[model samples]
Target: MTKTLGRRLFGFGSSGRSAARNPGGATTAADCLRLYDDAAAAGPVDAELAEAAAAVRQLPAADPGMTDALLALGGAALARDLPPLALAAADAVLTRRKGSRAAWHLRGRALEVAGDLAGAVEAFEGYLERTDAASAGAAEVTARIAVLREAHSWRQDVVGALDGTAPGVGALAAGPLPAFEAALGRHLDDRLAAAGPEEAAGLARVVGLHAERRRHQLLPPLADPLQGGTGRLRIGEFRNLVAGRSVCLVANSQTVGGGALGADIDAYDLVVRFTSFRIDPAATGERTDIHVTGHRGALNWDRRVTTRLVFSDRPEDWRQALRTRLVPGAQRFTGDDSLRRPLRTVGGLTPERWPAPLTCGFEMVWLLDFLDVSPRLDLIGFDFFATGHHRLAEAARIAGPSDYSSEKAWVMERAQHVTGPVIALR
Candidate 1:
């Protein structure tokens, strides 16, 4: 597979310049049309492209139609490996039209080229209903649809056993993605043969976590908040291939709320502590930091939030461990047999603070950027962070997981969703 190109590779593009340059410049609609024509020219008319781009940028915040046109131009630039221009154009469009299908579609394509499959999928799916199969931009829309469908199908198949859609004990027994499954299983079997049972057990924990992550899709936790000894919170795991870090260390956790009042403070605190571990840090002397940002959502609606942390240099051994633990149970694919078994405990710390009536979730992203310094990262390290925001509401409405009463716990429950901002650590 070809890698995503960066802004540097495309010479001087829009991202290279400051947003202030054309803040008060004279860039009109006609100027954007001219800029589009010039960008399509053969040689490096960097100056001309910049001028036109600046002009186009000024238009998006003023007019939606112009914003769409700029997004289209950005797509064109991205197709030519002009990362800087394409991204800037997309950024401009997205800024004004945050939920615009055209903006998201264009950004998705750019992300794909940047080797950000996860981000690309997110953007593409965001515009799913807007892009028609036979529209003027049918090709781009269709391409995105194809990519998302394949990835979605694969994810569903891999996690099918976990969801009780299949009756299997492990991935191999699941019989989904036969070839990929086999390869993963074989690799794990060999590793297990060489590992101590404790290490093997740790590996198993990783595998189980991987599946549970997909089964939840970063939704708020669905468990009794006070069930486990440490007080329960729903957790999801996701791995991202970030390009600028090394080792699988927690980058940071961010939470938003009303001054951390009620159960939110304790809940957010638990997440912060859990995700800040220095996984295998001794072997790779790289410093990993986890920054937690918090915000408050409506207290009555769905109180769900998404937190994404970068895991640099994830170990392949982790993936191997997962394959060993899950593949064997995949064959019987018929029920939640795989999840019915408790996950082996891995080397992680649970926070001491136990918060009540609060929910949150985690997106433990295995950032690809960290792999460069910590080459041990594995394929199983995509993006499987966890969440527990929903747990609080469930706790409020219904009794804890151990409490089997079917009666509602809280009538006027609001969901507080948190979405972590992308923190680029260069």
Candidate 2:
């Protein structure tokens, strides 16, 4: 594992830097240690990281203080995806550096990569506490501690709130539509009262789906219940940040009625990033710029989702196209095409789409505002996540990746809801 660890560092897809660098005229123990420290800060999977990892491995063989370097190298190896090697390297470091924080950090990272988040968190916390207060990367280590804490908090909140429950919008079984409606209405009203009219309308539409699902359980309705998509969708806006000339608002909602029965929830998860905003510096008019996609809900299920919108002095033509054209085109798929293609198209002015690896600092304001006028849908609720572009970008990176699995892919497909790791267990 130790031998292969060096080679594994060579094929990383991202940066190509080493974890450590050799400064001029420095071969002393202090200089070597400092270089290894620099390498860790530079990051693992770097050009010098391999050398640093090797140096650390060898350092402990000669000097005891170099045990810290050995431990750090193990963490670097794991970050570089050389797990077996990382395990061996970390073990080597821990053998001599028994109680050193760097060794523990490496072990923690290795465990984390091995899918032991809890264990990893414990080790990282211990390492942070043991490390010197004035370490070069102390701030970063502190930030990591915060991140782990937040992730833990968020995970707990989600589990406590929704764990062991169904994972779908349909979790509100049809047997209790009246109760569901009452409860849902109260929830919506309480949370969304302060939102704009458009947001309120959009949110109401999402709630309306609950009512519709109660009447027909895979059975046809006696007649088309009111013209479909005719009502205004509700949007429940929550947080709003005042940008220089524009305002960045974060809104979320329980969007029901977007999918038909037996729709997939594991399909590609949709992330709406707000790119830029168009606001009048002179006048206080409201306008924003953004892109939206992932229309094909979950696993290519036919669902109308508005990804992004660009507002203007006149009106957002592209947004209307999404509501009128692209969404309908996606609805036409008869299970033959890939479920994701509907929301993954390009080269059309209608819903002007872009490829994946989406831009950050963008949001779905147009749809959020549009939800206000469209009443047939429900806009559950929105959360104010960040204040500005920097925060927004940070939020985007933290939102994690999407899950796009088909309904047919899991045995629990018929259940009202699904939770915890959306993907099917191996």
Candidate 3:
């Protein structure tokens, strides 16, 4: 990346300085080193950073500290919004040490900032190859790769659509629902072809439901689901409702119905449940503070529920639910379709190649954590889709498109960690 190109893309001027000087009016290697450290920590364009960069350039060709200095300067440059300088520093380190993992990681970040998505992927992959896959660093890089790849694909689609080179790109404009339905159709077809008669019959029902959803788009898209759209409560408003208060999230797993935790669940400050949840007073809670559901299936809205939150990647699906499934006298809320990919980045919980849509239950977990809702958040009846025993018959019969294994692992890991809210698995 050239300085001129960086300036044009990032709208920042280049740092200009001649050399580093001490109070005694003389420059030394120690002073230069200190300046580099200060610049890296400060993370801004200033006389100190410019002087450090100039002094580093004057170092001896084979200086032993050259690589380290360059790495530090690269980080400083990246923090200061100088992608060109960061890129140059990363390149210098790689040239000196071909297998330098830090250099490749730095290059990847700089490329990402410079809007070179492809190059960023290449550099990050290089870093991943050199790092241990079992390490936390590897997990973070894997998540980063997933995000970058999605961004790259979305950017390509946009460009192709603008140039009249991509025909189905318009499907994206409608939201992820169209693409999800197409993928689900293919998945069902492949499974049906290989399944026994009984399994095939169940798969056919799923296909029928999918088709019904498409045929029932009787209304136009709903208003945006973000804060300023429709009757949705602001994120801050929801946060205030739950912050510092005990919260319980009840799932539809059959295992829950076997237990007698209803009173415990209802005792919390708030009780939340997913779509089609059962109401066995002794097993499941009777109170419904919030009801969360997707666009598909029948919405059995409880009369006592105070709020209804709808989640769908497709605006049309949300609109359909609002028109056909919404219950009166309840506060309504929904998430923006655009938040799907970005929300996946929350807690780095998603797998490296998750093409399927997230389940409404999993999204609620992520949202609660993102909002820092409460100190103690209880998870009831969640077996991560294991045993496939849902309260609703159709839900138990058909497997949805979500990656259950990944969601389970993410929740398990979060439960084991100490940083976030205490996610008590019941």
Candidate 4:
């Protein structure tokens, strides 16, 4: 991939400064068009193209008003499949308007398509925080963050181009390709890891906090606000409503076979399932009394489910999606999943301050701790290890039992304290 990026990124017909210099910082709409046309036509005029690129780079530095035109040029470059150029254009815009949410989004999009996942994550983070908590496609951006966080978990096997070359982060721009860029990413990871917890956590806060920040609902305390304390008024009331009724937590594990125990699960007074996970009455029974999720992807099913919800991340957005579906008695989780935050911490994960981990099954089990119920907590479809027959394996294909070992140990050590009689169906 690094070789591909270099081969495609470099080799621009010999060199950028080969022939003549056109002098950069030309501020004009015509200059933008000329640059786009020159690059798109793929002529052998490296000097002309280089000069044009240099000129585009000067747009934001020259004057603040060029942001709009630079944005348009960046959009054009993206449409033409020139992601690097698009990034440059967006960077130019950011230089002038550092807090420009649109520019951050543009940079994030370009970096993602260009295979710079780390840069993409940073840019997207900047965008989310720059935008005032409410914007179009925020859900999609949130989902993208959830995925990129997962990608950052694994290390890349990188080798320099030269036989016996020492690995260094600086070599990313000058090394013999291979996984040079990915090596830069690893180097960044290593540097951050070595930077001590305080500095590391600061950067992490930038990435994680904005991704799935739980909007605190500090109205009136219901039931001590320290135990079984939830943000939604309906949820607090539901706890009183359900009182001592038994609640079941079901996951989409191979054990369930897509609703094979629908009847059994539905028998419980309250049934909770994860986000985007479907339940067929024919297979698992359709009693989605309460749904819990940490993904923004659940935004798509807003109108689909009239059942109550408990969100960890993007809770504010969920409020808008389920506005009509919500009733006065419905409950929500606005940053009150105290159980989830600690679970991620145990797994060596910040996970965006929500239950937005690779597999939320364990988090689901732990979720029972936060509910306002003392009923029997029967768990189904939870194969602590992924080495089981999952009825809906595809839903969790990208998700694996990566962190199950430690999480399992955590559960075993404290299962007895989980608010009710714990029973594992698998």
Candidate 5:
């Protein structure tokens, strides 16, 4: 793969680099492109690719193949979980060719990963302007723009509430203001009618809270607000239950449906499943020892499941889930936002280099490792969307913006080196 990509990129034999080097042994465009291909063939975190990207960025804008190299480098950076570098490469291409639709699309994805939701929307709009509206690419971009716009609006509202800038937001800190809550509920209902499934869930949460007269919990607290006295198992208690037990994390990938591994899955000492997961006695097991979910969607699990973990980096997400989704008398737990990506602590990456929001399936795997699940941790239906099918079609829609490529790479690397609770991708 490396040789083929290198040859195609440089228009030379894989072993040939005659024109790639300059008279003074300085790097050339061909050299940088070849480096990029090599790095891409390597894993997601290749030092060579980083160095090549830096060298490519330094090349003169007017140099031959500079735009092509930058465009390719931008995509490679995104795949490698380096959003800032990807954004830089996209900007470089746009500077050279303002009408580059591919560059705009790349910029949109990079910005989204970097948490610049509004910037991402603008970049996607730019891409739309250059694309044929009737084309499939345009249709996909249109859907993406809608999702980003909704996310951006939600973020703005949450920020306003947090900073006490929105009208009546100041009253939230004091306690529930019935009048303000009623007004917000009406507003959310109007938006929910037009929202996509993902956004509608959040909007519905606010409306539900208002209806239930739990308006005071609509906004997230400034700190970890869950306590031991709240009918939740403490960290030690949760560890004691599953720390050394053989665990199986069943994802919603379609591959599991074909494996007929229901009995095999049930064989594990503890079975963990995600939100809205399906149960087929012949394909997916019916047991649910632990139910892990994100902020979105209503809880749907067997009543016998004792432990439920809500995973989200945003405080509002888990906070809302606790109020709206948690089943009464269930053992509740929430994931720490600091461990959401683990790029900074585990991979030695800066904030700019982290990937986009991960799926709950991947988060659960990481959480188990963090919680010291021992002996062996088996994974099923976790091909990272490689098969292009999910047990629930809505899940695919909800996870449309997640960075599955980078997550898959990270998991593969973890499986190789993780000692305790040795990962086994079944």
Candidate 6:
């Protein structure tokens, strides 16, 4: 198998969403050995990193330098117990070098050791996907996937929670009603009170999905049931920032076509993007003021971006980031507020729309209320990710058929809420 494919399944580099691997760098086996030794010996990490960095400069597509350097860096970091750095190095290598036979093994090892069994499974599966399935390590990777499946089976936990909750508002436009809120609240409260060590992982996943579903309709009772997106920023504080200003939020959409770098798109006073947000500078303009995301919940786009980033579904991944950390305008939003409104407001909407009623509808309302409520907002390249068959199938399973499409329709209907202007860059 080629090294490049191997790397894509597991490579890591730079930081944030825009970071990509340099395709030009090539490394030799000799460089790999020397760098690995120094990186492993390491009086300081920077010294070893510098050695690997220097080597990458000389690498070309034909040479083995890039792969070797990344391996060396990953190995050394693993030796030092820096799993994140190790994972990053592996990921960086895999991005531009997709054919590496060893990249798969490296990524799987890093993810597994880091407690991200789901990601490890995906990495191993990806390795198996590109390489000869009957190859020497294929059996072991298949075994790993089996183990990971046990964890993914936890998806049923959320389904059960949804089934248990009494249905409410059919239309998100009406917001969460009384009967709906009561049923959902009881369920979330039970989860919150019952979440223990053994069930921490399952509960966390349930909470994450549940809260997100609530957010699709409108901000849940600010309880942030899952504790995933909760940060220091408060609701009013978020709203005040953009209450009367011009703001722009960009989404990673295939429909951007050739307008990503268009001058009008770049002219927005502020720009917001999501996790592992990627764009070609020449194709997409170079302007990003804020990044709104909470790591790759189901995709290994970027390793444990938040301290809340959970690697292991076996353990809770919803811990809070340290107060002292510097993520630059990045924050979380685990719902945290008390709701006291007419129960009918929530109860009035029937479950006819959604038996469970939480679709990942346009989260802009939640954003407008809690994040940046810029009166004038432009949502660019914001297609509902409805292009591919795979996405369609996934959406069917996750959001139900009608809910996803309805969400798009709802967002389009609410365009007037955005300071009387709704620009569709598609």
Query: Which candidate wins on TM-score?
Result: 3
Quick one: how many clashes does candidate 4 have?
9
Model 1: how far is 161 from its true place, Å?
A: 17
> Which TM-score value belongs to model 1?
0.26
Q: What is the descending lDDT order? A: 3, 5, 4, 6, 1, 2
Q: Can you give the TM-score per candidate against the true fold?
A: 0.26, 0.25, 0.41, 0.34, 0.41, 0.31
Give candidate 5's TM-score: 0.41
Candidate 2 residue lDDT tens string, 1-426: 232343333322111111111111113334334444543554444664566556554653567435545544555556555543454455555555556554565656554444334445666766667654543234446666676565445334433443433234123322112333355445555647687878666565444554454445457655422213322111111111111112223122112112121122212122222332122222211222223233221221123323233222112332233344333333211111111122221112133343333222112332323222221211111212221122222233344224213212222332233332121111
| Model 4 C-alpha lDDT versus the unseen true structure | 0.50
Q: Rank the candidates by TM-score, best first.
A: 3, 5, 4, 6, 1, 2
When 1 and 6 are scored with lDDT, the better candidate is 6
Q: Model 4: what TM-score? A: 0.34
Worst 10 residues of 2 by lDDT: 234-243
Residues 208-323 of candidate 5 have per-residue lDDT tens digits of 54454454456676543343223344233355457558898887767776667888889899999887687777888778888877667564632447677666555556555665
Candidate 6 off by > 4 Å: 1-231, 294-317, 320-361, 369-373, 388-403, 417-426
For lDDT, the strongest prediction is: 3
Per-model CA lDDT versus the true structure: 0.35, 0.35, 0.60, 0.50, 0.59, 0.45
Give the Å error, residue 28, model 6.
72
Tens-place lDDT per residue, model 1, 283-314, is 21122222221122212121111222211112
- What are the clashing pairs of model 5? none
Residues 1-426 of candidate 4 have per-residue lDDT tens digits of 232433364232212222102112233444445545645455333453444454455555466436655665666566555655666666666666678766777777766555455666788888788543543336558889887665443212222222133345433433222244446445446657678877665455323422332122234545432112234322223334344567777766555653357787778887777655665676667777666554343332332333434443344454444443333333443222222233542234565543344455566565455553555766666556353544333454444445566666655665544422235422
**TM-score winner between candidates 2 and 6:** 6
Q: Give lDDT: candidate 5, residue 172.
A: 31
Give one digit per residue, the lDDT tens place, for model 3 in 32-139.
345445444544456645654764767785795566667666766776666545666666777677687777787787766665556677888887898757543466
- Cα TM-score of candidate 2: 0.25
Q: For candidate 1, what is the total of clashing residue pairs?
A: 96
